[model samples]
Target chain A: MIRIDAADDPRVAAFTRIRERDLTSRDGCFIAEGEVVLTGLLQRSSFLIQAVLLAERHEQRLGAAVQAATAAPVYLAGQQTLDGIAGFPLHRGVLALCRKPEPVSAADLLGTAPADAVVACAFGLSNHDNIGGLFRNAAAFGAHAVLLDGRCGDPFYRKAIRVSAGAALTTPHAVVEDELDLIAGLKSAGFRLLALSPAGRSSLRQVRPAGRVALLLGAEGPGLSDAVMSRAETVRIEMAPGVDSLNVATAAAVALHHLSGRVEA
Target chain B: MIRIDAADDPRVAAFTRIRERDLTSRDGCFIAEGEVVLTGLLQRSSFLIQAVLLAERHEQRLGAAVQAATAAPVYLAGQQTLDGIAGFPLHRGVLALCRKPEPVSAADLLGTAPADAVVACAFGLSNHDNIGGLFRNAAAFGAHAVLLDGRCGDPFYRKAIRVSAGAALTTPHAVVEDELDLIAGLKSAGFRLLALSPAGRSSLRQVRPAGRVALLLGAEGPGLSDAVMSRAETVRIEMAPGVDSLNVATAAAVALHHLSGRVEA
Candidate 1:
């Protein structure tokens, strides 16, 4: 175990940009924290261990992770110094920065995906928490994969990752450059392109189609662009009168629950 | 038109604490903002208008509100001073400190509430944004009222009001001292009390209850207290595989939609 209590350590630079989208532009990349999320990352073996930053008190707990590593530099810092470097208060004393995962191809996602995959097709969502919450909902309801559309923020952003509780790492997703093409692609694969809108003609629960079903959503305000709405099947979630619409993430949860056939009538 | 450019002016104190709670000791007072929400307050005429703070630029736009006679103080401030006092950029410059509405009896709520009213029955939720978001969802989903358990934070907190986009003022809620008693009261009154649980046995969409239904939810972490759950009907939202539970606010939105009967198959 290496112990150093310096806030200006060059090694800790990667953990600093977590609040911003540019997470550690160094060669060694990817950042995740918390025991629950870090366990999943380590179990998946997606990234090579670059360094482990932890408090002096947690040396034993963090040592376990470092001992199993093949090769990487380890830095130990005090609580205040660690907090200074991370730019936020972290509950779990451990943090890991590993190489980013290889980007998945659209074909890879499609080739491996099923016909009736409960999916969230995200478009124009900027809030990291919303994106994270969407993924968390997706994971809870048994979605096959999450497909990202244009104008959406990076899913790997620290805030999004924490809000998602690290499901961003475990859940499968394909980032498509063209939102229209992604919807069309899903439809061609026999997946029902279900768009959630206040003005949708049909209730989300009533629209029962065969095979793969993709729950289409957009940012809170300007929900599903007119073009996207025109291309996909329109569905409204029946709400009590006066209520306008649900948050994109919340709607995703409800849809996932319904699509998963888990709702016990 | 009145314009004062001092951050320390006593008038904007309540507005300044919009996101920060527990800083003031004065009871029976909460904050409200925006033209729609402020207008709704004017229409209800239930609470005292402690003070109305307006931006000089919005003098003509907010003329009608200022013209109303309610006995509350009307204070004006410039943009720079307002920004410094509030500590955050506000979309709308108008703010009002109104008296807390009289607490409603559970009996009255059940009897008068719409048969299909969507009520966000909160238990132990502390986040102002979550509370506000729940109110916003409740309002947007056409919920008739919000029944907050005493353990929950005050909805009149500036952050809560702002998070709800001023919908906090639009909705009606009866704060109860004992949540179990309220849950029982809801049950005895023939209101279906459906508790939101991630491990719920049934999906909300599959719930086919007739007459008055109350969508019951607890705080984000240890959702719906055990006592409340034991007394109320337990139901879950089906979600994608491996995803964690949705955020409290997001969950509320989904549940509100599901209970509103808009997602019926």
Candidate 2:
């Protein structure tokens, strides 16, 4: 590992703006922190690695993973300096800079999944943590793909990536520019569009999936706007009467679990 | 609404120590920000109100709720002073001080609910925010109660309460001294004991509730310590083959939504 003593070293500067770098995607890249997440990225299909930053004291903590990397820049910093630079007190000894996976074309993603697969379409969920959590659920429950309609925060945003526990890196997803085109395409593909709502006549359990299913989810409040709701019929989760609905991310998980679990022998 | 100008006013000091409040006792209080959660708390039968703090700038946003508070202290502060005292800039013009509901004794909680009741029993989930999210799901899918076993965090802890959006106020729950006693008690009460597990023979859907059911959940990672696991039969949510598990809170919501719907219908 290359060693550095100054916080301002150009090598560490990119790591310093890790949050902002992922937030704005100025360099079209984001940083992954902690050894597990970094290793996850390293093992995944051909993601571009920009660099690796670690504490000199942590070389043993990350030795195996570092040796596997062929060309990524590897640098060592003092514990205090690394902590000061990463901002979060617990950096877990390793962080990596990787090129953001190019957003998939809506056309390409729609074509590959099975005709009866369950896909999660998230809208207006600007909260990075929620988006990440959604992705984690999407991955765990076997969503064929997750799409972020316009106005949702980038699922690859740094905080979202971390909250997803590195699942965002493995889960196949795309952000499409045209909302209507994407929805129409799903319909053309024979997917039964089910929108999650608190007021549906029937809860999710009653809505059996017939073909490909695209579950449309929106932010917690101002839930799936009327414009979007009008596109797909509203569906409810049979809740015990009189409490507010689940958080968007949590709601997405249940929906994925519900939709996927159906027809599993 | 009574107006005050200083951040140091003792009248609002209870609001100030919010982040540090003791959450162990039934009467210990917590803060609920934003109007939606405040409205949820107002209508639910579970919590007692302790105080209401409002920003003078947003008095118009809370006139109705404040006018209804008969005896609870209503302290008003300027936006700047409110920000200073709150330790974070909060735009939610209204904040409600809510007393923790007296926890239903484990015996009473299990005794009263239907044999099919889907209860979430948390063992040693120490993070307040995760506990808060758990309560939010518990509230959403109609968990009969959230029982904090001996090792769990206080769900009434300030951060937990705030994160739960005040659902802790309306969700019937208790922190029992002994989990084994409750487990034995519930079994005798005819409640099916299902512990969520990554390794299990039965999918959650296949395990029909036999009257009242208590779902035993544990903290994320090192899930359901071996001792607790042995007490209950294992139940797994059928998942994507590669995926091992869902977040505990997410898994709780999935289980509650699926099981509660069966009973609610």
In terms of TM-score, the best-performing candidate is 2
The 0-to-1 C-alpha lDDT of every candidate, in the order given, reads: 0.74, 0.76
- Give per-residue CA lDDT, model 1, range B117-235, as digits (tens): 55678888888889988888888777778888878887887778777866787787888778887787787877878888987877676777667888888887788878888877788
DockQ of 1: 0.59
lDDT of 1 by residue, A196-231 (tens): 888898877776656777888889889989999998
Quality of model 1 by C-alpha lDDT: 0.74
Give fnat of each prediction, in order.
0.76, 0.89
lDDT of 2 by residue, B84-192 (tens): 6776786876677776565578778777886557788888788787888889888877888888887887776666776787777668887777778767777887877
Error of 1 at A118 (Å): 2.7
- For residue B123, model 1's alpha carbon misses the true position, in angstroms, by 1.9
Mind giving the per-residue lDDT tens digits that candidate 2 earns over A129-223? 89989988998888888888778888667678888887888888887666676688778777788989887656787777767899988898888
- Give the least accurate 10-residue stretch of model 2 chain B, judged by summed lDDT: B17-26
